[model samples]
Target: MDFNMIAARGLVLLGCGKMGSAMLGGWLRQGLAPGAVWVLDPHPSDWLVAQGVHLNADLPARPAVVLIAVKPQMMGAALPTLAAMGGGDTLFITVAAGTTIATYERILGAATPVVRAMPNTPAAIGKGITAICGNAAAGAGDLDTAEGLLAVLGQVVRLEGEHQMDAVTALSGSGPGYVFHLIEALAAAGQAEGLPADMAMTLAKATVAGAGALAEVADEPPAKLRENVTSPGGTTQAGLKVLMDPDTGFAPLLRRAVKAAADRGRELGQ
Candidate 1:
């Protein structure tokens, strides 16, 4: 939460899309001077324009950090804009998926401190979890700085190595989508059981949201929490019988889903 260093040195944001704006909002709320931030976005939002930040302005020569929040497809076209500021103390932190540290080092200089982060879409609401890993050129101080900035979005976890990022991407990065799909399916099932469509959807949404909130604050593990709800031969047990089936249940299904996602991530990184 200490903004003295970042405030004094200035911070450059390469893109000001949803994720970028979310992080920016968090920073500003935490008392960061808007003048200290210089954002470079081709299509800046009206909200971004109204924030009083230096939008599309000339960046500082040695800014404290240059956060890349552009899409992975746009990275090749966007990164070179900040090439001049690379290979120095300015730490480069990228939330762009599938872009590797080696690619950044090759483009921005091997000496540039780079941190790769995978943050989910929930970051737009400051309720996401982000996993970060730094390249060899990045030092402890650089990681600390990156973690501090990203913490504004949500919880931040440090990875032991960059290789773990793929699994992290599969699990937490794409997890929100999986949960959304679960909500859709649950609502559909309820409708098939004679509930009205709108009522089913509302019930499904609240059920999932309440369960997730409980999981977040609960002291016991999720399995234990589930056990607390299931009776020997009650309706919850009947539902668990299908969901926890040995051959065709959530465990195997989710394993395959996560593996497919991780495989695709590895392929994209290649």
Candidate 2:
């Protein structure tokens, strides 16, 4: 797709923190016009300046899309700047976790088309999964606009209902931390098995990274894939047995953790 064409429409990113900067980098790397982006960050980074992007504390006139990437706590304070730009044609896409469309309506009026998204940290590499849900005021074209722009970051999935966003946040939004912890655990286990610290870390990191890559391209079910590498009387199976045993398996714990995160997401949205 021609990302440059889309970028020409003028997009304002309201934050330049990690996630926001990642999205900006992805768009620019994919041929987005530097002039089309206006980044609003109190403390602008050197990289942003090098790319010839506009970094200002003041909000500009209504752009086609005003992406709200501020922290949830700072989102309320950021709304007043958007007040001058909230109208029929303009769209507000928020990446702030837990804040709802109702929250946007409260500040920008009910008629403003607002889209809420839960994006993972992997977007820093343009390989993230972003789940988005827009308010009723957003028409088909508006939704398409939001989706197309976010697609620059990674895959885009539109939810049937906004309620599912809590679950999405719990899963993908917090999923990276869980995976990172698993990597740490695997490395620790390797070290416990008499391996050198550096070697164990490398093995754990490569193993997890390779597994993720394989799973992405695999046609078979994950369970079947797991079985494929596990021999009946092998070291792999021995490890699998420990992980698969129902009494103290990893599933139950992970399920509880995800549920807890989902619950917390709901509470935050409240």
Candidate 3:
């Protein structure tokens, strides 16, 4: 929690979109000195300026951390200006999708230390979980620093290898959309079963939210939790039979969805 490094050299935030703002806000709330952060967005919001962070100003000779939160499509244009920032003690942490460590190293230099992270949309509220992977040039200290900074958003998990990043992108990065879709599907089904439209939507939303919260705190696995709720020959059991059907089940459907996402990620990286 010691922010001496941030205070001394400052942190560079390369983007100020929703995710970037959420992370920046969390950092400030968690004790990162506001004066020690720099905002690099081309069009700064009034709210961003009011936060007392340096905006589009000259940077220090060496920053403590440079977070690349710009869109992947913008990297080619943005990274050229950052070439001077590489090959030093500076740690370049990128959250841009499909921007590989090799891509960063090649743009910066072979000696540049880089950590790649995939954080989901939930990070906007500080409830998101992040998957982190670092290149060989990054040392233990570098990884620790990156993880600590990212923890401001939510949970942090370190991956053994960068190769697993695609899976991480598929599962956690795109997982929120899947959950949101489930809410929509459940709401629609509730309506189909004669529940009022608005009431069904409210129930669906609360149910999914409550269930996810419970799943997090439960000591038992989800399957066990399902069994705990089902009574023999009950309505829940009848529903389970159809939901757990091998050919049309949740597992196989989600497997196909995750695979589609992961494949697109690999293609983007290439």
Query: In terms of lDDT, which candidate is strongest?
Result: 1
How does model 3 score by TM-score?
Answer: 0.98
For each candidate, what is the lDDT? Answer: 0.94, 0.85, 0.91
Model 1 TM-score on a 0 to 1 scale: 0.99
Candidate 2 lDDT trough over 10 residues, lowest sum: 1-10
Judged by lDDT against the true structure, how good is candidate 3? 0.91
Query: By descending lDDT, how would the candidates be arranged?
Result: 1, 3, 2
The TM-scores, one per candidate, come to: 0.99, 0.93, 0.98
Give the root-mean-square deviation of each candidate in angstroms.
0.7, 1.8, 0.9
Poorly placed runs, candidate 3 (over 4 Å): none
* Local accuracy of candidate 2 as per-residue lDDT tens digits, 1-270: 455544656788988888888888877877888888888888888887898987784445667788999988888788887786775677889998878888888888888999888899888788899999889899887778788878867899999879899899889989999999999999999899899989999999999999998998899988888999999999999988888878787887888899999999888777
Cα lDDT tens digits, model 1, 170-201, are 99999999999999999999999999999999
**TM-score sort, best first:** 1, 3, 2
lDDT value, residue 182 of candidate 3: 96
lDDT of 3 by residue, 1-270 (tens): 678987899899999999899989888888888889988998887889899988998887789889999999899999988889899988999989889999999999989999999999888888899999998889999989999988877899999999999999999999999999999999999999999999999999999999989988999999899999999999999998988889999888999999999999999888
Pairs with steric clashes in candidate 3? none
